[model samples]
Target chain A: MSGPKPNELIEKIDYNPPQKGWMDVPVKIRKGMYCYASNPKSVEYVHLPHARPWNPLEEDWKLPDNWKEIVHNAFRERLDRFRSFKVFMDICVRCGACADKCHFFIGTGDPKNMPVLRAELLRSVYRNDFTTAGKILGKVAGARELTLDVLKEWWYYFFQCTECRRCSVFCPYGIDTAEITIMAREIFNLLGLNIDWIATPVANCYRTGNHLGIQPHAFKEMIEFFVDDIEEKTGVKVEPSFNKKGADILFVTPSGDVFADPGTYTAMGYLMLFHYLKEQGLNVTWSTYASEGGNFGFFTSHEMMKRLNSKMYAEAKRLGVKWILGGECGHMWRVINQYMDTMNGPADFLEEPISPITGTKFTNAKSTKMVHLSEFTADLIYHNKLKLDKSRNDNLIVTYHDSCNPARGMGLFDEPRYVINSVCNHFHDMPRNTIREQTFCCGSGSGLNAGEDTELRLCGGLPRANAVKHVHEKFGVNMLATICAIDRAALPPLMDYWVPGVGVTGLTEMVANALIMPGEAERTTNLRGEPLPGMEE
Target chain B: MRLDELLTQKKTAIIDKWFDVVADTYPADTAGFIKRQKDPFANPVGGTTQKSLTVLMDELLGEMNHDKIDSFLDPIIRIRAVQDFTPSRAISFVFSLKKIIRNQLNKSDFNDHRILAELFEFDLKIDLIGLTAFDIYMKCREKIYQIKANEEKNRTFSAFERAGLIKELPGSGPELA
Candidate 1:
C-alpha cells in the first residue's frame, strides 16, 4: 500500500498581499471560479467594442492592440457621465466596515471578494492611470499599471460581485462598489470582454423587448399559455389583455418570470391576481413591446440601461395607459427607485398610479408613476379588498429572503413582509444580520445569473444558502418565500444543493394560493399543484 | 483495571481532544463562533462543525457500531469541501485524531498487553472514520460540480427549447412559450 501521499497539511494561499505597494502579485484564474465569455453576436448587437468570441481560459483573449487606450477613454467618459464613480474611486478611506459585509467574502473567504478589496482591484488601476499620488509613488501608493493581466484581474473580480450594494449600506462615506463594478464591466465590454450571462440578456432585451427574446407574437402566446394554466388551476377562464390601446395600467415584469420554471408560477400568480382585479372592472394591459421590467443593461452600463428603460414609458404612452405596475423583480426596482425618473422620466403622459380597486394613491412613485407589485398587493390586503384564506399556506413553514436590490437600494423591505404575512400564517424571518438592508444576494444577480458561471454563482451563493439552511434546520422551514423573480428561479437549486428539502416560492404565488377569488373552485392544492394540508389524502 | 473500562473512562477526554484538533483548523474568530453559539441560525457553519465533530468523535471512540457515520461526517465534510482546503488538507484532521489518541494511551498504559490490543482495535476504527471522511469530502465536491452543470443547463433551458433544441414531452409539466 502507498504510504501517506505528501502534501501540506495547511493550505498554501500566499497570493493576497499587504496594505499597499503590492501590485505584482499575479491573479490566479482557477477553474470553476470565473464566468465564461459572452457570445460574439450578443456583444455586437449591443454595439460594444471588439465584439468577438473569446474564452476566459485560453492563453490569448484576442483583445485589441489599442485595448489599453480604448479602456482608458471609456473610463474617462464614465468619470464624466457619473459623479458617483469619481467619488467611489477617490473617497475610499479603506475603513474595514464593509469587509465582512459582503456575502461573497463570507462564503468564499477570499479577501478579494471583500467589497473593499474588490473595489481596490480597479482602484489600483485607476491610481496608475489618473491619480497624481499613484503616478508619483507607483505601487508604493497602492497603484498598479493597467497591464493585460490587470484587465483580466478586474474582469474576474468584478463579475464575482453581484453588484448587490450590501457593502455600500455599511460604508461610512457611502461608497458604492456597485458603481465601480458597473463602470469596470463597461470598460471590459469595450474590449468585447463580456460574460455571456449579462451580454445575452442585454442584446435580447434590446432586440425583442425582453431578455428571453420572445418575439411579439410569441410573447402574447406565452401569456395565453399561462392563462390556460390559470384556468386549469383556479378554474377561472380569465382572458388577459395584451398591447391593447387605451388600457389604464401597463404591467411589466422581468422576462425571466414569463419563461422560467417556478418563476412561471409567480407569473401565474400575477395573472390570477390580475384576473380577479379585471373581473372587478379594473382595466390594465400588458405590452408585448415593453414586455420586460428587469434591466440587464443596468449590469452593462447606465447608458445601456436608459436605452432598455425608455421602452416601458414609451409602451405606456403608446398603449395610452394611466400608469405602470412593475412585477416582482430586484434590480428593476433599484432602477425605478433611483435612476428611472432622472434618466427617462417626468412620465408626463401617465397619471399617478391610483389603485383602481383599493383607491390607494402611490405617492412614493409620484415622480416615476410606477408602483411595485408588493406595495399594490399590500395595500389590497390593508384595505381588506381581497378574500384571503391563511390556511391555504398552512402546509408551508415559510421565511422571507429579502432580495438585495429592493433591500439595500430602495429599503422596500416592510412592504413585501407585509404582503407575505397578510397571506400566509407561517411567516418567519431569517437571522437579523442576513436580512433587510444587510440582505445577501441570490449569488446570480446582474448578468452573472447565466448558466456557464454556475460554480461562481454557487460559491457566491453559499452565504445566502447557509443562512437558509440555518432556518431550515432551526424552524423546520420548508419554504423560502421571496419577492424577486430571479430569487424564485435561482433559490430552488440553491436550496436543493446546499439545504435540501426547503422549497422556494414568490410572495405573489403564496398570495394566489390564499386569495379567495370570488366564484373560484374550492382549492385542493397550492400553485405548482402541491397538495394543501387536508387535501394530501 | 481492564482496558475496556479504562477506555470507557477516558472517552470524554479523547472526544474533547478530537474536537480541538478539527476546530483549530479554522481561524480563531471562526472557531469562536462554534465555541460560543449553540443556536444554528446564529452561526450555521460553526454549528454544523461543532455538532458533527462531536458525534464523529463519539462514534470513533465508542463501539463504532452504527453505519450512521455519514450522518455525523457528511455535515462537517460538506463545509470543509467548499473551504479553500486541498483534499488532503481537508481530510488530514481525521488522521490527526489518531496521533492524539495514540499519545494519550501511550502515556497511560505502555506496558499492558490487554490495553495494547484494545488500542489497536480503536486505532483501526479511527482509520475507518478517516476513510469515511474522505468519501464524504469527495461526494460534496462532486455535488458542487454537478449542481453547476445543471444550473448552466437550466438557465439556458427556455432559449434552447424555443429554438427546438429541447422538445416538449408529456408529464414535463407546463410548456415553455
Candidate 2:
C-alpha cells in the first residue's frame, strides 16, 4: 500500500494487449523475417510482369497503375482456370482443425500464421470481391477490400508458409492450403513482387538451366571436383559423363549439391554409387541443361515451373537416354510425381524407367518416365545388387527427415527409409507424428532459404528441431538423414543452432559411405572427410 | 514451516502460476493453445515454457544449481529470443516469479518479521536467477546472429570458390587467419 498497489505492479508487466479484431490490426513488417525484394534484372530475365525494383521495407512498393485491376483480373482468371482454387476458396469452414498444425504458427505464435487465419487473409479479400454475401454484408461477412496494406500482409504471410501441407493433412475438408499460398504467390509475381531468393533462382534456372547460373563447363568442372574428392576418399575414380548422347539413363540433381557443402558430400555419394554401377555396364549421363532438380520456379509461378521443368524431358530426349533418374531432391520429385507428365510430358520419346542393374521396371514412374534416386536405390538393394558395409556408418545414429513435398505430394515414405535402413546400422524415427506424412519441413523449402531471413527460417524450424532434439536426447541421434538437397543445405545450420553435435546428411551420402565398390582401396574416411567409425584416430 | 519447506509445499501452485504468467507473454489465442496442448512435439513453445518453469521453481526452492537452471532456461529463452520480444520482456518471466511468490505469501502467517526477512533473501535469489536468464537470453540472441553471419559467409565463400575467386575459404575471422 505504501510503495505501489498490486494492480499497478501487475500493470508494470507487459502482458496486456489491445483488444482489436485481427483485420483491424495493421501489419508490422519486421526485419529479419522477410527476404529482400527481387532485383529488376532477375525479374526481367524471366520476362515476368512489372519488372521494376521495389523493397518490402520501404513505404512505396512501386506498384503499377491499375494494380487493383491487374490483381482482380488475375484472381478471376485463376478462379476460373483452376476449379480447385475456386473450390478451396469456397469450401473452408474455418473449423480450426488445421489451426495449430502450421509450423510457422506454432513456432512464431503469430495468430495470422494459423492455417485458418492465413487463408482467411486472402479469403477476406475473396469474400469482398468475389462473393455476393461479401458484396452485400461487407464486415459482417468477414470481407475486406484488398488495399495496399492487405497486399503487404498477403506477401508477408504467404512467403512465411513453406507450402509443407502439414495443415492440409489435418484439415477436415482436405483443402490444400499450399495451393492457396501458391495462388497468392502467383498473384504477387504479377506485380513483380517476388522475393530475391525465388526470383534470382528462377532467372538463373531459366537462363543457365540451373539455379546458380553455372554454365555447362563450370557445371562439369564442379562435378569433376567432386570426382576428385571421391577418388581421394575411396581411391576409386568415378567417370560421370555429361551431355553424352545415347546413354541408357540421364541423371539430374539440384545444382545446390554442386555448389554447397554437405550437399557436395551428397553429390560425391551419387558419383560413387553411379561409379559402382558403371562396372556393371549401367550407362548414365549427367545433363547440364537439366542440372537442377529442385525447381525454385515451382515457388515462383506455375508457368515458370513448367518452363523450367520442360528442360528435363527435353534434355533427356536430346541425350537419347532411355529414361531419366532424378537425384535426391524434394520439390523436384513433387513436380515430377504430380505435374511433370501433364505439364511437359507424353514423354513418349523416353522409355519407362527400368533399373539397369536390378532389371526391375519402375512402373510408378512409367508415365512421367523419371525415377527418384531413392526408389531406384531401394530397388537395387531389394535385388541384392550393391555390396554394403553398414559398419562404415557406425559413427552415426541416423534419423530420417521426410521432406515436405516428397512426403505429402507423393506418398514416398518407405523408399527413402528402406534405403537408409539398408545402408546405415543405427536408424531411429523422430516420432510417429513428425515422420512420413506428418513430417515437419526443414523450414527453408519453397525458395525461402536465404541468408537474410535466417531468423524466420530458424523460428519456423523450431518444431522440427524440437522433435529432432527429443530423439537426439533420447537415442543420441547424430545424423539427420534426408533425401532432400534443401534439407542438406538448411538443416545443418538448424541443427547447429537448436541441437548441436548433430549433423545433416543425404540418404545417398549414407549409401556411399557404406558402399564397398569393387577394386576400391580400404576406405579411411566417409564423404565429408570425417574418418570412418573405427578408423577415427 | 521454514521458507524452503513452505516453498516446497507450495511448489505445484507456484509453478502453475509461473507457467501461466510465462504463457501469457504470448498472444491470448496462442497462450490458450499453449496451455491447452499437453504434448511437447505438437506445442513445443507451450511445453518448453511449462517444463522450464517447473524445473526453475524446483531449483529456486532447492539448490539453485546454475547449470540446471541454465539448461532449462536455454529452451525458453532461445524461443523468446527469436520471437518478437524485447530483451527485457524476453527474460521478464524470471522477475515475474518474485511477484507470484509475494502474492502467494501475502497472508498474515507469512507477514511475520522473521518470514519477511526470509522473503527478502528469497527475492535476492530470484534476482540471481534473473541475471542468469539475461545471460542465457543474450547468448541465444548472439547465436542467432552468429548463425546468420556464418550462413552468409559460407554462401559467398562457396560461390567464390566455385568461381575460382579464392583458393581457400577463410577462417572464422581475420584474427584467426
Candidate 3:
C-alpha cells in the first residue's frame, strides 16, 4: 500500500513581524500542526503545543475570528446538554477513597485510574469558570477552568471511569464520581465528539434496540443457540418463544450472557429450567423478542436510559407477558430498581410476580412484576419445587460472587446464594464486606468490558480480584459464581489478569450441570435431546 | 423503660453537658454572640476555589493598589464591612437559635439531629442563609419544638406507666410523636 503513508509533522507558523527591535524571527510556531500526507518523517503529532506559536494580535486566537460562529454554534449546541459546569464542581469531593477502588489502580498501580484524580481533570475546569479562587489561584485548592483543551482531556479520562459505583459505596458523602464522568462523556457526545467504542453501542441501542447491535433475527438465533446448548446438555428441545402471542413470561437477559462466557452457561440453565417447568405443565411461555434486557444507555445519559427501557417495556407489552425476567446484569438492575418506575410507567399487566406453581406472592414489587432469574429459580427451589439433581455438580467447589447491581442496588443478596447452595454442596461465602450490598464490581462491570477502557477496567477490577483471590486462597474457591451476565463476560478477563487459575461461572451453569435426566422421556438425551451414548444404570 | 425512652433521657443529659462546656466559654446570654455566629455565608467564599483577600478587597474598595493602602486600615474596613454585611447579622440570629437547640439536645442521642446541626454550621457561622436558608432554620426550629412534643409524649407515657394506663413499652396509646 502507499508504503505506510509519510510521517510528516505539519507545523503552522504564525508570521508576526516585530516592530524593529523585537526578536528577528518572523515565524512563531502555533499550537496545532498537521503533517502533509506525502511527507515521510519519523515524528508524527497532533495539537503539539510547540508546533504553533500563539499571538494575541493575530485574529486566529480570537473566537468568531478563526472559525465561523455557525460551526462554533453547532458545537456549542451539542455541549448544551453536558453537565453544568456548576454541577460538576459541586459533586466531587476528591477524597481519594475511589483511588483504591479502581481496577486500573489495583492492576497497574496507575494513579490515573483513581476516580478522584480522574475527576480532577474535569473538576479543575469547573473551578476555573465558576469559582473565584480558581480564577485567581490555579491548581492549589484543586480547581481548574474548562478550556477546549480541558474538554478534550475530560473526554479522555471521563470515559476512563466505567460509571461503576464501586467507589461510591464507600464514599462517606455518597458522592458518585461516576456521575461526573458520565456527564463529561455526555457533554463530549453532545458536541458530536464520540469515541468509536462507546458511540457504536449507543448507536446500536438507538437503532436495533439493543447494545449488541444484534438485529431481531440475530438475537433470536442467539436464543436458539442457547436452546441447542440446553438440548445437548440435557435432552430437551426448547423453542425459545420469540414474539409469541400472549406468552406468560418475557425472559430478558443481558445479550452478553447468551454470546459470551459464564453467561452462556447461565443461558443453558435458564432454558433447562423452562423446559422442566413446561414438562410439569407450568404456563411459562418465555420469549426472546425482548431478549436483551441490558440498558447500555445507562452508560450514556438519562435520556438514552429512558429510550432503551421504554423499548423493553413496550416489547413486554407487545408480547403480553405477565412477568418480565431480568437476567444477571449490573446497571440493568440499577435501572430496573432505581429509575425504571419513574422513567417507564405503571406497567399494568405485570403484577408483583406471583409464583406460577406455589401461588406465593412477592410483596416489594414496583415498576413492573420484574423478577430476577436467580430469584425466580431460587424461590422455586426454596418451595420444594424445581426438581434438582444436586450430585451432578460435584465437579465444582463454588463460592457465589454477588454482582453489585443485584446485591447493593436491588437487594437480591439471598436468591443466587440459595440457588447455588441448594445445587452445590461446596458453597462458601466470601468475606462479609465482599458480598451483598458491599460486593465489589467485577472491576469490569458496565461497558468497560470493551477494548477502549481496558486499562481502566484492569485498575478498577483490582479490589474485586483481591476479594476473589482471598476467597480462592482461603476456601480453595476453584469456581467463582455470579448471577449477572456482565460479570460472566467481564470477570474472566479480570481473573486472568489478577488471579489466574480461579474461574468465574454463572450460578445456572452449576444448575444445568446438576439437572436430573428424565426417565420416561421419548428421548432421554443431554442438552441436544438425543439418546445418551454412555448409559449408566 | 423502653430503650428509646432511655436513649432520649441520655440525649437530654448530653445536651445539658454540652451547654455546660459552651457556658464555660461564654455567657448563657451568649445567645446574642451565637446569633452573630449564625450567618450562613459570612465567609463570602463560594465554589470550590481558594479564597484571596487581595482580589476581593480590591473589588470592594474599587482600588487596584489595595495592597499599597495601610494594611491596618484594610483589616478594620474589611472587618467592619463583614460586620455590616447584612447576611452575617442574619446568620448571627440563626446561629443563636442553633446554639440554643444544641444546648438543649444531646448530640449523641440523635445521630440524625447531630448531622443536621453540623450541616447547619454553614448557616450559623457564615450568615449566607437565603430562602433555602430560612427553610433549614424552620426545620431545625421544628425539631427543637418536637423535643418538647416528644417530652410531653414521654411524660404522658411515663404517667400512663405510673397510672397503669398501658402495660407494654411501645405503648398502645396514641404513639409518641
Tens-place lDDT per residue, model 3, B1-177, is: 332333345544433433333222222222122223222111111100012222322322234333433331222122212111233332232233233344454566446754555535433332322233344334433443443354346446645543444645422344644
Candidate of highest TM-score? 2
* Candidate 3 lDDT score at position A35: 9
- Tens-place lDDT per residue, model 2, A1-537, is 379987787777576455578998789898879999998999998899899878898999999988999999999999999999999999998899999989999988888999999999999999999999999999999999999999999999998999999999999888999999999999999999999999998898899889988999999988888887788878888888889999999999998888887888888888899999997889999998888998888888899999999988889888888998989899998888888888998799988888889789889888999888999899989989999999999989989899998888899999999998898888999888888999988889998999888879988999999999999999999989898888989998899889998999988889999999888899998887778988968
For candidate 1, the lDDT comes to: 0.80
B1-177 in candidate 2: lDDT tens per residue? Answer: 677778888899989988888878877788889889998999999889888888888888789899999899889999988887888888888888878887777488466888888888999989998999899888887888888878777776777776777656421222210
The lDDT of each candidate is: 0.80, 0.88, 0.54
Error of model 1, residue B119, in angstroms: 5.4
- Report the number of the highest-DockQ candidate: 2
Task: Tell me the deviation in Å of residue B172 in model 3.
Answer: 70
Candidate 2 stretches with Cα past 4 Å from truth are: A1-10, B168-177
Q: What is the TM-score of chain A in candidate 3?
A: 0.77
Weakest ten-residue segment in model 2 chain A by summed lDDT? A11-20
Summarize candidate 1's per-residue lDDT along A114-158 as a digit string, tens digits. 798889988888898889999999888888888888888888889
RMSD of each: 4.1, 2.0, 25.8
